[model samples]
Target: MTSVKSSAKAFVSEGALSEIVVKIMDDSVVEFLVGLGFVAVPGKEKETLSLIAPNQEFKVEVFSRLRDEGICFSVGPDWCPAEVFEFLRDQKKLTGFYRKIVWEGTSTPKIIENC
Candidate 1:
Protein backbone atom coordinates (compact mmCIF):
# COMPACT_ATOMS: atom_id res chain seq x y z
CA MET A 1 0.00 0.00 0.00
CA THR A 2 1.20 3.50 -0.84
CA SER A 3 1.74 6.01 1.96
CA VAL A 4 -0.51 9.07 2.04
CA LYS A 5 2.42 11.50 1.68
CA SER A 6 3.78 9.55 -1.30
CA SER A 7 0.34 9.53 -2.85
CA ALA A 8 0.07 13.31 -2.42
CA LYS A 9 3.54 13.77 -3.93
CA ALA A 10 2.63 11.60 -6.89
CA PHE A 11 -0.60 13.53 -7.37
CA VAL A 12 1.28 16.84 -7.42
CA SER A 13 4.00 15.51 -9.73
CA GLU A 14 1.35 14.28 -12.16
CA GLY A 15 -0.02 17.81 -12.54
CA ALA A 16 -3.26 16.58 -11.05
CA LEU A 17 -3.21 18.75 -7.94
CA SER A 18 -6.86 19.04 -6.99
CA GLU A 19 -7.03 22.39 -5.29
CA ILE A 20 -5.83 25.99 -5.58
CA VAL A 21 -5.84 28.97 -3.24
CA VAL A 22 -6.55 32.42 -4.60
CA LYS A 23 -6.05 35.52 -2.49
CA ILE A 24 -8.42 38.26 -3.50
CA MET A 25 -8.07 41.74 -2.14
CA ASP A 26 -10.78 42.94 0.25
CA ASP A 27 -13.08 39.96 -0.33
CA SER A 28 -14.11 41.65 -3.54
CA VAL A 29 -15.16 38.47 -5.30
CA VAL A 30 -17.67 37.70 -2.58
CA GLU A 31 -18.96 41.26 -2.75
CA PHE A 32 -19.21 41.06 -6.53
CA LEU A 33 -21.09 37.78 -6.39
CA VAL A 34 -23.48 39.17 -3.82
CA GLY A 35 -23.90 42.31 -5.88
CA LEU A 36 -24.72 40.14 -8.89
CA GLY A 37 -27.75 38.87 -6.91
CA PHE A 38 -26.37 35.54 -5.71
CA VAL A 39 -27.56 34.55 -2.26
CA ALA A 40 -24.73 34.04 0.25
CA VAL A 41 -24.80 31.05 2.56
CA PRO A 42 -23.75 31.79 6.12
CA GLY A 43 -21.27 30.25 8.60
CA LYS A 44 -18.06 30.36 6.59
CA GLU A 45 -14.90 31.25 8.57
CA LYS A 46 -12.70 31.86 5.54
CA GLU A 47 -12.68 34.82 3.22
CA THR A 48 -14.51 32.78 0.63
CA LEU A 49 -18.30 32.86 0.65
CA SER A 50 -20.68 30.12 -0.49
CA LEU A 51 -23.32 31.33 -2.92
CA ILE A 52 -26.56 29.71 -3.95
CA ALA A 53 -27.62 29.34 -7.58
CA PRO A 54 -30.76 31.18 -8.57
CA ASN A 55 -32.19 28.23 -10.50
CA GLN A 56 -31.51 24.73 -11.72
CA GLU A 57 -30.46 25.86 -15.20
CA PHE A 58 -27.97 28.31 -13.78
CA LYS A 59 -26.58 25.66 -11.46
CA VAL A 60 -26.24 23.15 -14.27
CA GLU A 61 -24.48 25.62 -16.56
CA VAL A 62 -22.04 26.66 -13.84
CA PHE A 63 -21.24 23.09 -12.86
CA SER A 64 -20.78 22.07 -16.51
CA ARG A 65 -18.41 24.94 -17.23
CA LEU A 66 -16.41 24.30 -14.07
CA ARG A 67 -16.15 20.60 -14.91
CA ASP A 68 -14.99 21.47 -18.42
CA GLU A 69 -12.27 23.67 -16.95
CA GLY A 70 -11.16 20.87 -14.58
CA ILE A 71 -11.88 22.98 -11.53
CA CYS A 72 -13.09 21.31 -8.35
CA PHE A 73 -16.24 22.57 -6.68
CA SER A 74 -18.88 21.32 -4.27
CA VAL A 75 -22.64 21.60 -4.43
CA GLY A 76 -25.94 20.08 -3.42
CA PRO A 77 -29.60 20.40 -4.42
CA ASP A 78 -30.10 22.66 -1.41
CA TRP A 79 -27.89 25.25 -3.10
CA CYS A 80 -30.92 26.18 -5.16
CA PRO A 81 -33.56 26.73 -2.53
CA ALA A 82 -37.20 26.89 -3.58
CA GLU A 83 -37.42 30.67 -3.15
CA VAL A 84 -34.19 31.37 -5.06
CA PHE A 85 -35.99 31.62 -8.39
CA GLU A 86 -38.37 34.25 -7.08
CA PHE A 87 -35.50 36.09 -5.39
CA LEU A 88 -33.49 36.19 -8.59
CA ARG A 89 -36.49 37.27 -10.64
CA ASP A 90 -36.99 40.23 -8.35
CA GLN A 91 -33.30 41.27 -8.32
CA LYS A 92 -32.39 44.47 -10.17
CA LYS A 93 -28.87 43.26 -10.96
CA LEU A 94 -28.25 41.68 -14.36
CA THR A 95 -26.61 38.33 -14.74
CA GLY A 96 -23.36 38.56 -16.77
CA PHE A 97 -19.61 38.61 -16.47
CA TYR A 98 -17.84 41.66 -15.14
CA ARG A 99 -14.05 41.85 -14.74
CA LYS A 100 -12.55 43.28 -11.57
CA ILE A 101 -8.89 43.77 -10.70
CA VAL A 102 -8.27 41.46 -7.78
CA TRP A 103 -4.51 41.89 -7.66
CA GLU A 104 -1.92 44.57 -8.47
CA GLY A 105 1.84 44.42 -8.56
CA THR A 106 4.28 47.14 -7.60
CA SER A 107 6.77 46.08 -10.28
CA THR A 108 6.55 44.76 -13.81
CA PRO A 109 6.08 41.04 -14.25
CA LYS A 110 8.22 38.82 -16.49
CA ILE A 111 5.13 37.56 -18.29
CA ILE A 112 2.87 39.81 -20.33
CA GLU A 113 -0.65 40.29 -19.05
CA ASN A 114 -2.20 39.21 -22.32
CA CYS A 115 -0.26 36.00 -22.29
Candidate 2:
Protein backbone atom coordinates (compact mmCIF):
# COMPACT_ATOMS: atom_id res chain seq x y z
CA MET A 1 0.00 0.00 0.00
CA THR A 2 1.21 3.53 -0.67
CA SER A 3 2.07 5.75 2.23
CA VAL A 4 -0.83 7.85 3.49
CA LYS A 5 1.26 10.83 2.52
CA SER A 6 1.00 9.61 -1.04
CA SER A 7 -2.79 9.00 -0.79
CA ALA A 8 -3.87 12.31 -2.24
CA LYS A 9 -6.47 11.70 -4.96
CA ALA A 10 -10.03 13.01 -4.35
CA PHE A 11 -13.28 13.45 -6.36
CA VAL A 12 -17.00 14.46 -6.05
CA SER A 13 -20.01 13.62 -8.22
CA GLU A 14 -21.34 16.63 -10.09
CA GLY A 15 -25.06 16.06 -9.73
CA ALA A 16 -27.27 16.43 -6.70
CA LEU A 17 -26.20 13.77 -4.26
CA SER A 18 -23.92 12.62 -7.04
CA GLU A 19 -20.77 10.66 -6.49
CA ILE A 20 -17.65 12.38 -5.24
CA VAL A 21 -14.30 11.18 -6.59
CA VAL A 22 -11.06 12.73 -5.38
CA LYS A 23 -7.55 12.35 -6.74
CA ILE A 24 -4.70 13.70 -4.66
CA MET A 25 -2.15 14.85 -7.18
CA ASP A 26 1.41 14.57 -5.91
CA ASP A 27 1.59 18.19 -6.84
CA SER A 28 -0.24 19.14 -3.56
CA VAL A 29 -1.59 17.67 -0.32
CA VAL A 30 -3.61 20.08 1.81
CA GLU A 31 -5.28 21.23 -1.38
CA PHE A 32 -6.16 17.77 -2.64
CA LEU A 33 -9.23 16.59 -0.73
CA VAL A 34 -9.18 19.21 1.99
CA GLY A 35 -12.70 20.52 2.60
CA LEU A 36 -13.67 19.20 -0.82
CA GLY A 37 -15.94 16.54 0.77
CA PHE A 38 -14.32 13.17 -0.02
CA VAL A 39 -11.34 11.52 -1.72
CA ALA A 40 -11.54 8.80 -4.33
CA VAL A 41 -9.04 6.49 -5.95
CA PRO A 42 -7.62 7.65 -9.25
CA GLY A 43 -9.47 6.56 -12.37
CA LYS A 44 -7.75 4.51 -15.08
CA GLU A 45 -6.67 7.68 -16.89
CA LYS A 46 -6.80 9.87 -13.77
CA GLU A 47 -10.33 11.29 -14.34
CA THR A 48 -12.33 8.24 -15.32
CA LEU A 49 -15.43 7.73 -13.17
CA SER A 50 -17.42 4.77 -11.97
CA LEU A 51 -20.95 5.37 -10.80
CA ILE A 52 -22.06 3.99 -7.45
CA ALA A 53 -18.42 3.24 -6.72
CA PRO A 54 -17.47 4.40 -3.27
CA ASN A 55 -13.95 5.11 -2.14
CA GLN A 56 -13.37 3.30 1.13
CA GLU A 57 -11.07 6.03 2.35
CA PHE A 58 -13.56 8.77 1.70
CA LYS A 59 -16.18 7.20 3.96
CA VAL A 60 -13.70 7.33 6.80
CA GLU A 61 -13.44 11.06 6.31
CA VAL A 62 -17.21 11.35 6.50
CA PHE A 63 -17.35 9.36 9.71
CA SER A 64 -14.88 11.77 11.24
CA ARG A 65 -17.06 14.72 10.33
CA LEU A 66 -20.44 13.11 10.90
CA ARG A 67 -21.98 12.26 14.19
CA ASP A 68 -21.66 8.75 15.51
CA GLU A 69 -25.30 8.38 14.42
CA GLY A 70 -23.75 7.49 11.08
CA ILE A 71 -25.55 7.48 7.77
CA CYS A 72 -29.08 6.24 8.21
CA PHE A 73 -28.92 4.17 5.04
CA SER A 74 -26.47 2.42 2.82
CA VAL A 75 -24.80 4.55 0.16
CA GLY A 76 -26.24 2.44 -2.61
CA PRO A 77 -27.87 -0.94 -2.91
CA ASP A 78 -25.20 -2.01 -5.40
CA TRP A 79 -22.08 -0.37 -3.97
CA CYS A 80 -23.04 -0.67 -0.31
CA PRO A 81 -24.92 -3.49 1.29
CA ALA A 82 -26.70 -3.28 4.62
CA GLU A 83 -23.92 -5.26 6.25
CA VAL A 84 -21.45 -2.56 5.30
CA PHE A 85 -23.03 0.44 7.06
CA GLU A 86 -24.06 -1.84 9.90
CA PHE A 87 -20.37 -2.21 10.54
CA LEU A 88 -19.31 1.23 9.42
CA ARG A 89 -19.68 3.02 12.77
CA ASP A 90 -17.96 0.61 15.14
CA GLN A 91 -16.08 -1.41 12.57
CA LYS A 92 -12.90 -0.57 10.74
CA LYS A 93 -11.77 -2.19 7.53
CA LEU A 94 -9.59 -5.21 8.16
CA THR A 95 -7.17 -3.51 5.81
CA GLY A 96 -6.92 -0.74 8.43
CA PHE A 97 -8.75 1.88 6.38
CA TYR A 98 -12.13 3.47 5.78
CA ARG A 99 -14.54 2.83 2.90
CA LYS A 100 -15.34 5.61 0.44
CA ILE A 101 -18.87 6.22 -0.97
CA VAL A 102 -19.02 7.21 -4.65
CA TRP A 103 -22.66 6.42 -5.42
CA GLU A 104 -25.69 8.59 -6.00
CA GLY A 105 -28.77 8.70 -3.81
CA THR A 106 -31.99 6.88 -4.82
CA SER A 107 -33.47 9.83 -6.67
CA THR A 108 -33.10 12.12 -9.61
CA PRO A 109 -30.16 14.52 -9.50
CA LYS A 110 -29.55 18.03 -10.70
CA ILE A 111 -26.81 20.03 -8.93
CA ILE A 112 -25.58 21.10 -5.58
CA GLU A 113 -23.63 24.25 -4.88
CA ASN A 114 -21.17 22.60 -2.55
CA CYS A 115 -21.09 19.17 -4.25
Candidate 3:
Protein backbone atom coordinates (compact mmCIF):
# COMPACT_ATOMS: atom_id res chain seq x y z
CA MET A 1 0.00 0.00 0.00
CA THR A 2 1.19 3.50 -0.81
CA SER A 3 0.42 6.56 1.27
CA VAL A 4 -0.50 9.75 -0.54
CA LYS A 5 -0.65 13.27 0.83
CA SER A 6 -3.52 15.47 -0.14
CA SER A 7 -4.09 19.17 0.36
CA ALA A 8 -7.16 21.32 0.10
CA LYS A 9 -7.36 23.91 -2.65
CA ALA A 10 -8.28 27.51 -2.00
CA PHE A 11 -10.86 29.12 -4.19
CA VAL A 12 -12.19 32.68 -4.42
CA SER A 13 -15.60 33.59 -5.74
CA GLU A 14 -15.71 35.50 -8.98
CA GLY A 15 -16.40 39.21 -8.58
CA ALA A 16 -16.57 38.85 -4.81
CA LEU A 17 -14.33 39.55 -1.87
CA SER A 18 -12.56 36.61 -0.25
CA GLU A 19 -11.68 36.89 3.41
CA ILE A 20 -8.52 35.46 4.91
CA VAL A 21 -6.73 35.34 8.24
CA VAL A 22 -3.24 36.82 8.20
CA LYS A 23 -0.24 35.22 9.78
CA ILE A 24 2.50 37.04 11.65
CA MET A 25 5.09 36.48 8.91
CA ASP A 26 2.66 37.20 6.09
CA ASP A 27 3.51 40.48 4.37
CA SER A 28 1.90 39.81 0.98
CA VAL A 29 -1.55 40.42 2.41
CA VAL A 30 -1.14 44.15 2.09
CA GLU A 31 -0.15 43.92 -1.55
CA PHE A 32 -3.09 41.67 -2.31
CA LEU A 33 -5.45 44.09 -0.61
CA VAL A 34 -4.05 47.01 -2.57
CA GLY A 35 -4.89 45.26 -5.83
CA LEU A 36 -8.49 45.10 -4.67
CA GLY A 37 -8.73 48.81 -4.04
CA PHE A 38 -8.23 48.46 -0.32
CA VAL A 39 -4.97 49.92 0.94
CA ALA A 40 -3.73 48.66 4.24
CA VAL A 41 -2.77 51.35 6.66
CA PRO A 42 -0.64 50.36 9.62
CA GLY A 43 -2.43 50.33 12.93
CA LYS A 44 -1.58 49.39 16.48
CA GLU A 45 -0.79 45.67 16.21
CA LYS A 46 -3.10 45.49 13.21
CA GLU A 47 -3.99 47.10 9.91
CA THR A 48 -6.73 49.54 9.04
CA LEU A 49 -8.11 49.03 5.54
CA SER A 50 -9.23 51.94 3.38
CA LEU A 51 -11.47 50.74 0.57
CA ILE A 52 -11.82 52.51 -2.77
CA ALA A 53 -15.06 50.92 -3.74
CA PRO A 54 -17.52 51.79 -6.49
CA ASN A 55 -19.13 54.66 -4.69
CA GLN A 56 -19.18 56.52 -1.42
CA GLU A 57 -22.28 54.67 -0.31
CA PHE A 58 -20.64 51.29 -0.85
CA LYS A 59 -17.47 52.34 0.91
CA VAL A 60 -19.37 53.65 3.91
CA GLU A 61 -21.45 50.51 4.11
CA VAL A 62 -18.53 48.10 3.87
CA PHE A 63 -16.28 50.06 6.22
CA SER A 64 -19.03 50.38 8.79
CA ARG A 65 -19.88 46.69 8.63
CA LEU A 66 -16.35 45.30 8.66
CA ARG A 67 -14.69 47.84 10.89
CA ASP A 68 -14.35 45.36 13.72
CA GLU A 69 -13.61 42.32 11.61
CA GLY A 70 -10.01 41.15 11.73
CA ILE A 71 -9.98 39.60 8.30
CA CYS A 72 -8.21 40.44 5.04
CA PHE A 73 -10.44 40.49 2.00
CA SER A 74 -8.90 39.59 -1.38
CA VAL A 75 -10.37 41.35 -4.39
CA GLY A 76 -9.22 41.97 -7.96
CA PRO A 77 -9.40 45.17 -9.94
CA ASP A 78 -11.89 43.65 -12.42
CA TRP A 79 -14.31 43.28 -9.55
CA CYS A 80 -13.54 46.70 -8.10
CA PRO A 81 -14.22 50.16 -9.49
CA ALA A 82 -10.84 51.64 -8.60
CA GLU A 83 -7.65 51.37 -10.63
CA VAL A 84 -5.60 49.94 -7.81
CA PHE A 85 -2.61 48.89 -9.92
CA GLU A 86 -2.33 52.36 -11.40
CA PHE A 87 -2.69 53.89 -7.99
CA LEU A 88 0.12 51.76 -6.61
CA ARG A 89 2.35 52.53 -9.59
CA ASP A 90 1.70 56.23 -9.32
CA GLN A 91 2.45 56.16 -5.63
CA LYS A 92 5.85 54.50 -6.37
CA LYS A 93 4.93 51.50 -4.25
CA LEU A 94 4.46 48.85 -6.90
CA THR A 95 7.19 46.67 -5.54
CA GLY A 96 4.96 43.80 -4.51
CA PHE A 97 1.87 44.51 -6.53
CA TYR A 98 0.84 41.61 -8.79
CA ARG A 99 -1.83 40.97 -11.35
CA LYS A 100 -3.31 37.76 -12.70
CA ILE A 101 -2.94 37.39 -16.42
CA VAL A 102 -4.43 34.48 -18.34
CA TRP A 103 -3.26 33.43 -21.76
CA GLU A 104 -5.32 31.93 -24.54
CA GLY A 105 -6.26 28.28 -24.00
CA THR A 106 -4.52 28.29 -20.65
CA SER A 107 -6.56 27.17 -17.70
CA THR A 108 -3.92 28.19 -15.23
CA PRO A 109 -3.44 31.85 -14.33
CA LYS A 110 -0.09 33.58 -14.21
CA ILE A 111 0.72 36.07 -11.50
CA ILE A 112 2.77 38.91 -12.96
CA GLU A 113 4.22 42.01 -11.41
CA ASN A 114 2.17 45.17 -11.93
CA CYS A 115 4.97 47.56 -12.87
Candidate 4:
Protein backbone atom coordinates (compact mmCIF):
# COMPACT_ATOMS: atom_id res chain seq x y z
CA MET A 1 0.00 0.00 0.00
CA THR A 2 1.18 3.52 -0.77
CA SER A 3 0.34 6.58 1.32
CA VAL A 4 -0.64 9.79 -0.42
CA LYS A 5 -0.83 13.29 0.98
CA SER A 6 -3.82 15.43 0.29
CA SER A 7 -4.28 19.18 0.75
CA ALA A 8 -7.46 21.10 1.33
CA LYS A 9 -8.23 23.85 -1.13
CA ALA A 10 -9.51 27.17 0.19
CA PHE A 11 -12.82 28.20 -1.33
CA VAL A 12 -13.19 31.81 -2.44
CA SER A 13 -16.15 33.55 -4.02
CA GLU A 14 -15.35 35.00 -7.41
CA GLY A 15 -15.57 38.83 -7.57
CA ALA A 16 -16.76 39.15 -3.98
CA LEU A 17 -15.34 42.12 -2.04
CA SER A 18 -16.10 40.47 1.30
CA GLU A 19 -13.74 37.68 0.33
CA ILE A 20 -10.81 40.07 0.52
CA VAL A 21 -11.52 40.69 4.22
CA VAL A 22 -10.09 37.25 4.88
CA LYS A 23 -6.58 38.38 4.11
CA ILE A 24 -5.48 37.32 7.59
CA MET A 25 -6.99 33.88 7.06
CA ASP A 26 -4.23 32.41 4.90
CA ASP A 27 -2.06 32.92 1.83
CA SER A 28 -4.42 31.07 -0.50
CA VAL A 29 -7.31 33.36 0.33
CA VAL A 30 -5.02 36.36 -0.07
CA GLU A 31 -3.98 35.16 -3.51
CA PHE A 32 -7.61 34.77 -4.55
CA LEU A 33 -8.42 38.28 -3.35
CA VAL A 34 -5.49 39.67 -5.32
CA GLY A 35 -6.77 37.91 -8.42
CA LEU A 36 -10.02 39.83 -8.00
CA GLY A 37 -8.27 43.23 -8.23
CA PHE A 38 -7.59 43.82 -4.51
CA VAL A 39 -4.33 45.61 -3.81
CA ALA A 40 -2.42 44.69 -0.67
CA VAL A 41 -1.25 47.59 1.46
CA PRO A 42 1.89 47.21 3.57
CA GLY A 43 1.32 47.28 7.31
CA LYS A 44 3.13 46.32 10.48
CA GLU A 45 0.74 43.94 12.23
CA LYS A 46 -2.52 44.56 10.44
CA GLU A 47 -3.31 43.62 6.84
CA THR A 48 -4.78 46.28 4.58
CA LEU A 49 -6.40 45.84 1.21
CA SER A 50 -7.72 48.35 -1.32
CA LEU A 51 -10.15 47.85 -4.18
CA ILE A 52 -10.44 50.34 -6.98
CA ALA A 53 -13.96 51.06 -8.10
CA PRO A 54 -14.91 50.49 -11.74
CA ASN A 55 -16.23 54.06 -12.11
CA GLN A 56 -16.91 57.32 -10.30
CA GLU A 57 -20.55 56.58 -9.66
CA PHE A 58 -19.77 53.22 -8.14
CA LYS A 59 -16.94 54.73 -6.15
CA VAL A 60 -19.22 57.31 -4.58
CA GLU A 61 -21.77 54.72 -3.64
CA VAL A 62 -19.21 52.52 -1.92
CA PHE A 63 -17.22 55.36 -0.42
CA SER A 64 -20.31 56.78 1.27
CA ARG A 65 -20.93 53.44 2.93
CA LEU A 66 -17.35 53.12 4.14
CA ARG A 67 -17.39 56.63 5.51
CA ASP A 68 -20.61 55.93 7.37
CA GLU A 69 -19.06 52.85 8.91
CA GLY A 70 -15.91 54.75 9.87
CA ILE A 71 -13.55 52.30 8.21
CA CYS A 72 -9.93 53.30 7.66
CA PHE A 73 -9.36 54.01 3.97
CA SER A 74 -7.95 56.35 1.34
CA VAL A 75 -9.39 57.61 -1.92
CA GLY A 76 -7.65 56.82 -5.24
CA PRO A 77 -6.05 60.23 -5.67
CA ASP A 78 -4.71 60.03 -2.15
CA TRP A 79 -2.56 56.97 -2.81
CA CYS A 80 -2.47 56.23 -6.52
CA PRO A 81 -0.08 57.92 -8.92
CA ALA A 82 -1.46 60.09 -11.69
CA GLU A 83 -0.09 57.82 -14.46
CA VAL A 84 -1.32 54.65 -12.77
CA PHE A 85 -4.66 56.30 -12.05
CA GLU A 86 -5.02 57.27 -15.68
CA PHE A 87 -4.11 53.77 -16.79
CA LEU A 88 -6.65 52.22 -14.46
CA ARG A 89 -9.23 54.80 -15.55
CA ASP A 90 -8.59 53.84 -19.19
CA GLN A 91 -8.96 50.18 -18.24
CA LYS A 92 -12.15 51.11 -16.38
CA LYS A 93 -10.70 49.63 -13.22
CA LEU A 94 -10.53 52.75 -11.01
CA THR A 95 -12.31 55.98 -10.28
CA GLY A 96 -11.80 58.70 -7.63
CA PHE A 97 -12.16 56.34 -4.69
CA TYR A 98 -10.02 53.55 -3.35
CA ARG A 99 -11.97 51.42 -0.89
CA LYS A 100 -9.41 50.47 1.72
CA ILE A 101 -10.12 48.38 4.78
CA VAL A 102 -7.77 47.47 7.58
CA TRP A 103 -8.11 44.32 9.66
CA GLU A 104 -6.34 44.50 12.94
CA GLY A 105 -5.54 42.51 16.13
CA THR A 106 -5.59 38.77 16.85
CA SER A 107 -5.71 35.81 14.46
CA THR A 108 -9.36 36.56 13.81
CA PRO A 109 -9.50 39.70 11.69
CA LYS A 110 -11.90 42.47 12.69
CA ILE A 111 -12.54 46.08 11.70
CA ILE A 112 -11.10 48.50 14.19
CA GLU A 113 -10.43 52.24 14.38
CA ASN A 114 -8.16 53.68 11.71
CA CYS A 115 -4.44 53.36 12.29
Highest TM-score against the true fold, candidate? 4
Q: Model 2 lDDT vs. the true structure?
A: 0.33
lDDT of each: 0.27, 0.33, 0.34, 0.36
lDDT of 1 by residue, 1-115 (tens): 2111100000000111222222222343444434434333244433443434455555544433322322222111332221232233346322322111111346321211110
Q: What's model 1's overall lDDT?
A: 0.27
Cα lDDT tens digits, model 3, 1-115, are 2222221121122223332223222344455445545544356242444544565345434432322222222234474312433443356543232332322354443323232
Off by over 4 Å in 3: 1-83, 93-99, 113-115
Over 1-115, each residue of candidate 2 has an lDDT whose tens digit, in order, gives 3121212133222312335332323323323234433333454543432233256565555433321212112234444432343465456542233323333556432221111
CA lDDT of 110 in candidate 1? 20
lDDT of 4 by residue, 1-115 (tens): 2222222122111112322222233344445445546566567232445566666555544434433433324212333222332344566654443223322443332222222
Using lDDT as the yardstick, the better of models 3 and 4 is 4
Q: Can you tell me which runs of candidate 4 are displaced by over 4 Å?
A: 1-46, 72-115
TM-score of each: 0.26, 0.24, 0.23, 0.27
Q: Ranking by TM-score, best first?
A: 4, 1, 2, 3
